[model samples]
Target: MLMAGCAHFAGRHPLLGYTEKDHPQADTALVVCAEQEQYICGITGVNQVATWEKFNGGKTPWVRVLPGKQVIKLTLSNSHQLNRQQVTIDDVQAGHVYRIDVGFNATLLTASYTDLGKMDAYTIHMPRFPLSPKAITASF
Candidate 1:
């Protein structure tokens, strides 16, 4: 079931200098196409305005309104921690609206944020991939 709200991110930052190979779980994560879906996969406690780490535990997908002018920071966890991972986007201008899509498990999530603070978070549960429709070949 897709939870209809802003949810938290899970796991640690690909384990430092991690690559696609390092991420055994990457395959388990929903496959996302940039054109079909828009999202940013970030780690919590990694990128914070206060600190300088870029990869931490947890995941946060945030939309930037007026990026590079007035930025907003977001963090997530796997129901264990809260905003522990500090991922910060700096110099986000104040005006332009952005839609960020995050891929996790069988769900595609989103978060709306700005200089003010968190606005809302929602989830779009994804259906099984390699769609059954596409699996069928056209006979015509």
Candidate 2:
């Protein structure tokens, strides 16, 4: 899994991706992964409503997010179509993997979320139609 962080540390690389050896004491950890070949995508974060990490080529990006209502969307690199998913992050404990995958059904896009640490699973169907300009703008 590929990862990125906000603040930089001295002599530390701006980018880092690796498994956490120790227990990470936090509210929640979100791992957004997409397997669309030849397509680049990204997941939106809460602050400033911007895309956090770009899923380029063959890497999965992860970040730590607060436990609350979070709107996650995958923006295609070369298309206007956005596969969106709304997740209510509640009862998520640290040291667990909450994985979300963006996939397609025929031509329509979809999302499947699973907590590997538990028995929870969820599937969401993205919007059939492209979002209107006003509908998209109000979100930011």
Best by TM-score: 2
RMSD of each: 17.5, 13.6
Q: How high is the lDDT of residue 116 in model 1?
A: 30
lDDT of 1: 0.27
Best model per lDDT? 2
Candidate lDDT values, in order: 0.27, 0.39
lDDT of 2 by residue, 1-140 (tens): 12222111111111122223242334344444433444434454433354443423222234444444444444443243555454544555444455666665667556655665622322212221243211110000
Clashes of each: 26, 0
Q: Give the deviation of candidate 2 from the true structure as CA RMSD.
A: 13.6
TM-score of each: 0.22, 0.44
Candidate 1 lDDT, 1-140, residue by residue in tens: 23311121212121221223443331212111121233434432222232223222223222212233323343432332333212234554322223332334444243333333222322223222333211211110
